[model samples]
Target: MKLLMVGAGLSGAVIARRLAEAGHRATVIDARPHIAGNCHTERDPETGVLVHVYGPHIFHTDDAEVWDYVTRFETFRPYKNRVKTTARGEVFSLPINLHTINQFYRKTLRPDEARAFIAAQADTSITDPQSFEEQALRFVGPDLYEAFFKGYTEKQWGCHPSALPASILKRLPVRFNYDDNYFFHRFQGMPETGYTAMVARILDHPNIDVHLDTPYAPGMADRYGHVFWSGPLDGYFGYDLGRLGYRTLDFERFTETGDWQGCAVMNYGDPEVPYTRITEHKHFAPWEDHAGTVCYREFSRACGPDDIPYYPIRLVEEKALLSDYAARAAGEEGVTFVGRLGTYRYLDMDVTIREALDTARAFLSGGVERGVAGVPG
Candidate 1:
């Protein structure tokens, strides 16, 4: 069978490779000149520092199979994401750990003492929380919420925290212990060379043909037995039902001699600051040494027609429109929606690859319908 995989990122590459290995020819196409999509990484010519072209992506997951699969293509160096934040004219550790709590309040409380203190600070009166603001106040109280989350969330989503869903804030953790690791996954690391190099290896199969800078067109699926669309879900239907809301990022790049910032990610928790976070590219690849450093100051805003969509803003209105699109996608034939954009949700790289593998397996086992793999029901 001849298969078509749209958008040659992790989703398309992993699925295409699996199908190609199963004696089926696969053609992968990406609109961008690069193959890895947002995960693309390249080195700065002057400083020789590897820069994450889009933003910093740390591969962290507890899925052993996914970890093993990626390691087959490229060597992964041990990396832990220890995020930092600047708030109220002070630097603090992320995830609201014990150190952060003590530092912010200027008290040397133990783990148990800190937990009780935070519990006391929480607003127990609000038994049921509906919005992001209420959720934070119920858990961490106003002081931590205002200093760390309020400004950053507003800047990232372009809305007041009170307008957002509580589920959005539920993902973040408030740690009572001193552990400052950003993620709680068992396995966390980065590709030794770069994500682009790793994806290139994944697409290097005999039965797979890769074409870059090629946008998907109407009737392109006519020639193939099946199509896996990883592009935007609304885009496949020409956005006839109106466009879905998304938050896009604007990165301001700068280069400096010597180390600019000691950390990889330094988030600004002050609403007054224009940018949300600053990432030092060289710190991403600690194994390699470079005298000069490259950094990106990231700003988030609503995605326009020509902008590259990053996060799907699935507020109440967007969710209703997404349901309409998902229903339309279910009725389509010989096409499966299989990625973050296609499914209209935020996805990590590990989850994307895992779902891609599963989608390929389902297709090889005779499930080629639109709603088989990742389509929302």
Candidate 2:
């Protein structure tokens, strides 16, 4: 079967490669001039430091199959994301870990002691948490919430923490132990040659043709047996119903000598700071050494029509709009929606790859119509 894969990111590349290997022809198109979407990484022209063009992406997952699959394209060096935060003119460990708790409270407490201390600080008044603010208050209490989350949440989402759902904040762990690794996953690493190269390799097959800076038009789907869309769900229909909500990132790039933050990611938790975080790109690939550094100060705001959407703000209104779009997508006979934008959900790299692989395999086995994330069979 001939296939059209839109957006040459991990999703499109993985899907196209799989289908191509199965004796199917695939034509992959990306609006951008790159293969990896937000995971595009390149070396800074002057500094010679590896830069994550969109933002820093740490590849971490518990799934062994996914990890092994990624390793086939590029070798990954062991990299644990140790995030930092600046609050009230002080630097502290992220994920509200034991050191952060001790440093913030100015007390030396062991794991058990810290757990007890935090429990006492938690608000017993709120038995059932509903909002992000309420969940933080009940789990980490007012002081920690105000110090670590409140201002940051407001700045990142451009709204009050109370307006956000509890599920958003609940995913972040508040650790009692001394472990400062941001993610709790078993396998965590960064690609040696970077994500773009990794994906380019994935799309390197005889039966696959890649077209850069080419956007898949509505009429293009008619040329192929099936279309696997990884672009924005609203974009597929040109926003016929209504535009969904998303938070886009604005990066302020700079070059510096030596280290900038001495860490990969540093969150500015204070609302006074306009940008949410600063990332040192060189730190992302610690295995490689460089005298110079490349960095980006990231700012988050509501996504516009011309801007690339990053985080999907699946608010109540957006969910209603997504449902309408999904219905329209279901009616389309030879199209499958996969990946973050297609499904209108924020997805990690592993989850995106997993879904793409599944979607491709389903297609190869004559079950192309059926898929996860409302892809009708």
TM-score of each: 0.98, 0.97
Candidate 2 RMSD to the real structure: 1.5
Best by lDDT: 1
Scored by TM-score, the top model is 1
Q: Return the lDDT, model 1, position 86.
A: 97
Q: List model 1 lDDT by residue over 1-377, tens digit each.
A: 99999999999999999999999999999999999989999989989998889999999999999999999999999999999999999999998999999999999999999999999999999899999999999999999999999999999999999999998988889898999999999999999999999999999999999999999988899999999999999999998999999999999999999999899999999999999999998998899989899999999999999999999988989988888898888888889998889888889999999999888888888865675233355
Q: What is the lDDT of candidate 2?
A: 0.90
User: What shift in Å separates residue 164 of candidate 1 from its native position after superposition?
Assistant: 1.1
- The candidate 2 region of ten consecutive residues with least summed lDDT is 368-377
Candidate 2 per-residue lDDT over residues 195-314, each given as its tens digit: 989998999999999999898776898899888889988888898898999999999998889998899999999989999999999999898889998889999999998999999888
TM-score, prediction 2: 0.97
Error of 2 at 331 (Å): 1.7
